[model samples]
Target: MGSGTIVEVSDLFQNQPARLSFQRRPVTEMAKIVDIVMQHALSHPNVAFSLTNSGRIVFDVPSVSEYDDRLFDVLGTQASGLIPLSVPSEDENAPGDERWTGWISSPDITRGKGDEVHLFINQRPIASQPFQGAIRRGYKTRLMQGRHPIAILSLKIPPHEVDVNVHPTKRDVRLKHSWRVLERLERAIAHTLHSVATAPDSNASSLGIESIKETKTETETETYKKPSWAITATQQLTLSGDSARSLEPEKKRPISSSPAIQKTIFGGKPIAPALSSDERDIHRYSGIESERPDSEKPLSEIINELPEMEPLAQLADSYILVQSGEELLIVDQHALHERIRYERLKEDQNQWKPQSRISSISIELNPKEMSQLQAVSSTIKSFGFDFDIDSQSMIIHSAPAILTTSSIEDFMRDLLQDLSEDNQRALSMEKIKDEMAFMRACRGAVKANDKLSIAEMRRLLEDMRCIPNPWACVHGRPTAMRLTIHSLDHHFGRHG
Candidate 1:
């Protein structure tokens, strides 16, 4: 309010009765204002800008010639892992030719949607599928499936070479040499992602675990069984932060008042049918365990229900190897946990627990995300989040009592990405909530490289018996594979 110029509009669309009748809620209108302002801010960061909603400061960016500084201010910690790249055009001396410049998000940080991948042409934010595709092709297989990277790229093209009048809002533009521009953009994104990048913290890269048929499964506990290795089904499911080895009964988490997410989460629909186990390496390689054992229960459930088959050992921090009766089972820790978490989230929407514990977290959401939030705010709130929103940013004051701060954050961001692009919207509301639960489980579960104690390993395996679907994770990766004693003996010629 000091030296900055102020412009205010009051009583807009008052005379247009039809438009007013169809007008969006105040929150939606504020989001649109914020989206347009943010586009302008990113395009011209050197120009100081400030936004307020109901006299609350949403964002205030000081004029800065350095783009990185502006990004650090706006994106907060997300900007820290960004990799900078400056690709040159042929005409270095020519001022009108297009040149590419901006920062790319490190592989470690990605969004579920390309919404965060901003493209500015001639200092104007514009939309181009070719531009976005180029950026993605650059990342290649580095990002997980359905996940997109965050990028802020700018190009200064000559007036004749770029047409910005393609849309009424000037958000979509046509490049005269679209093919050549895309080739260069793709190469730049690929080169930047490959060179001088952020390496992931762990070496366990089995999140996309292949069904290894003949892979060796060995751990330090392989030499033992009774006391040190094999755990029974009864010894699991006492969720603990301090002690994992407790031999206690599963203590159920109480379901709080309807999910704090006041909407769109649960539809009271029946749980979807469980998927049949995909007989990967275990079936093809050994040619054993193909036929299900004589049991009334599903094969997936039978693996965990066998009284003596608790986790015997952990391998590479990614898998659990167990010598269960006549069969040896290999388990994907992340996959198992994901399946369990997903089912638990669905066991009763009431388990989400009321939102509590105000946090000092704030995030900026674009218009698309804002719309997405409005669409399913109820589902989100039920999961333990309480927040206030302004035009440009959401101030998170509370988080889910069930999940850690970072875990729910990832789930929400991923959810926003999933809800966007209208692809998933073709699904029913029940399916949508199921997907949200899947995402939450994926985010909350342990990763491949996380080291687990024997107790933790046994406990996780024990928890597996509790879920309806236990064979594979939500993405169709097997949670556990079965190998028979007969297969082992046949391989080593012990049977002969």
Candidate 2:
């Protein structure tokens, strides 16, 4: 009968020595316990929480209205950088079982390891890849490779809709609509981060940056001042009524000016004499010179040739800035390069032919690793990996065309680990090959913060525009974003 429930285990695994033997060291066990306590405390700030180690108090937090205070107490003073995340209230159309709330760190706050992230479901701490991926997808490109953002995500779902008994540790759960949850979480985090990025920072705005103010006229219509950078993309247009009207010219041409022109006429107006055969041919082929063939044309020419897009400056050495017509385009150099590489790989795959004489390489594996390899051996063979396995080790005779000698071992190991985790699904050779291509693209692609010349940046932009899926990389990360004049005007209060 107390308000709180207490769980205790006595003579744990006494009947199962194997289970006890598999337990981690005491120090590691203690760390896990502390992690569980910290997660629960952080998830439920309304409850007074305390943790102790060997009769000594580690942390104590009284009940508080704000979770930020509790976070500081648990995660140390550095937790101040974490941004409070609030998902929009579920709409009437939203599933009643779906609920998510969390706090995400700013782009400035990150960790080399993903341990900084804590996920909870129904006030219970969970360790699920889908949940973790949701957080990563939310942070998206704001964080760099190998660096994960700090987050504390809390989720709630209807009991009937979730299967919590899927994992022995109760960390993994099966959601009836897992994709919906992930999509919602990602959208909420992205919206918050976007708002923070676009919002004027107090310190920066106070440092002599001119502030744009919105004004209302007698007609109650909101008006904004024109942005200073409006002319940066192209020649500035004067909105003067007379000048604007004068720019438009009337079109009048004689029907017989060309033989083709004579084909269409409203009335029997005076038609000029038909041109000579040579002249008619000349006129017929006049505009043909402008039509560029796809094979011979450059990428810029293929994409309508954005002559007005003058290269401005690169941002953070990662995003290339170019003025396109009246819009500013920010292109992610790494993502752009990755997409290019992936497309090249795809093209190569289409033209791929099996090798006549495949070379062999020997691979050594421990017993555990060997077992893992055997489990996925058939899948590996289907992926163009010709190999022979024995009790102790395995020898690879041929490898995938996409993989190199140096990376093959690591690639095989990773694939084995993945297969060990998910054995039920039949592995698709195409999927495996695509993943290989993705890895190669990631490794060979340009990295962030890498300097580039103006010509190089322009070339990359041109290539991106020519690609079918130029907006995102192979991994679905955004490669470029266009900031329009309207958005800029709105941001700078230059609207009417």
Candidate 3:
């Protein structure tokens, strides 16, 4: 019996053991191994898999043929760190079976680390080195150096043309025509990166650095002037003679080129030259003055010289209303205040050293807000808003001269909002500056519905008349309009 048992044991060991090798191992040992394999397989569903232990089949999972929950689980895990982005795929004119869909990571979020990325073509995962390299190249300069983007790029190509059995794992795919796909991928990735990294935030005010500089230079130039010898010569010539023929030769000389002749003709003082009868008629129609007081004279001289406008009816709180011939004019009191403020601002902008004033005030902003403020610091400087920024808050050193009397908090809030908004719209700096100027004018102008005293109304009209475009407000709205006596007569049927 022992001999027979020994022979059986030998036979079993050689072919099939009575105590099987599988039975000798702990159940948990096999379970752990199976779990590891299953997890890996679940993580990459697109890749087909089959598992066996000691020639006995264990688990077999089919390849994923579409992007479903399984695919999303795998991709979403891989792209957790990236900024989510989406784009349209169908070109309106393209043929039916040639559509594609895909997503690219944002450059701002990528910041140069490129490992967390995946690609799919026709629902199959691919590890195409050449294609991934192209994506990296697109974001080369837009992101910080040495950082690679995280992306999950997918493309849809005609099924029959692409070979899914490129490798044993089935993760690799081969495209029969990949050049077009490659081009489109490059363009889309490049475009998305450019858009996010460089796009400005909306809410910042628009102001032109160059324009503010130019305006400052002009204001400075206007502050000081050489005596107007031409004015004196013109005044003397008018007093000396009324002969139309004599005035013709003087008028023929170019006003700027004949300074010497102007000095001799008008007594070596600067003022507008005398006008002939015909010239006076032309001047009256065109609104060009035939004469102006010497530049050295007080501004009141010009004001007094102006034709007397009707008296101001009443002073209602702050507004001023005046009558000009047949037209009634309404002006904003605040706008007038703003104009005065603007003039002072201009003067300060022109000076060699801007006037320094102090206020014990501070403004606080969150970290994100501070970053945006820092980004637009140079622009704010151009507007004469000198300040410092820290993580906790922004400190105001000085403000524009005109804004001194106003609430700093309110002004800063408005300015920041305006800048951010304009920046988002991508408006040019010049347009933003013009908008600011308009705001200042609106804030300073006189408000409607306010009564004004006769003196105040007369004063407002006189000042309005001196402005280059007296008929319109700074925003181009008509400040006053005329109704001719003839028109009134026609309206009454008297002309008929």
Q: Kindly list the per-residue Cα lDDT of model 3 for residues 1-496, writing each as its tens digit.
A: 1221111123545565655665423433444344444445444566665656557555555568653544343333323324433332333243334344445554433321233355667655566465865675555433333334546566767788778897897767777766655645654555454445332111111121011111112211111111122245545322111332233432242354566544443345523334443322221221111111121112232323334467455434544455556644454443443343333323333321333555544666422234346556777777666778754467877765444333445345445544443224544544544444544443333343334455555556555444444544443333443444555465456765
Which 10-residue span in candidate 3 carries the lowest summed lDDT? Answer: 207-216
The C-alpha stretches of model 1 lying farther than 4 A from their native spots are: 1-11, 88-96, 201-341, 348-351, 354-379, 386-402, 414-433, 440-473, 476-496
How do the residues 20-136 of candidate 1 rate in per-residue lDDT, one tens digit apiece? 876566766665566667777888987887877678665578889888888876676667778886453322343235577888887657666677877888888887555766776
Decoy 1 TM-score against native: 0.57
Q: Positional deviation of 307 in candidate 2, in angstroms? A: 42
Query: Could you give candidate 2's per-residue lDDT for residues 148-242 as a string of tens digits?
Result: 66788887788788898998989888988777777778767765675564332212111111111111132221112122333466776442223
lDDT of 3: 0.44
Model 3 Cα displacement at 3 (Å)?
Answer: 63
lDDT of 3 at 325: 66
Q: Which stretches of candidate 2 lie above 4 Å from their native place? A: 1-14, 88-97, 198-496
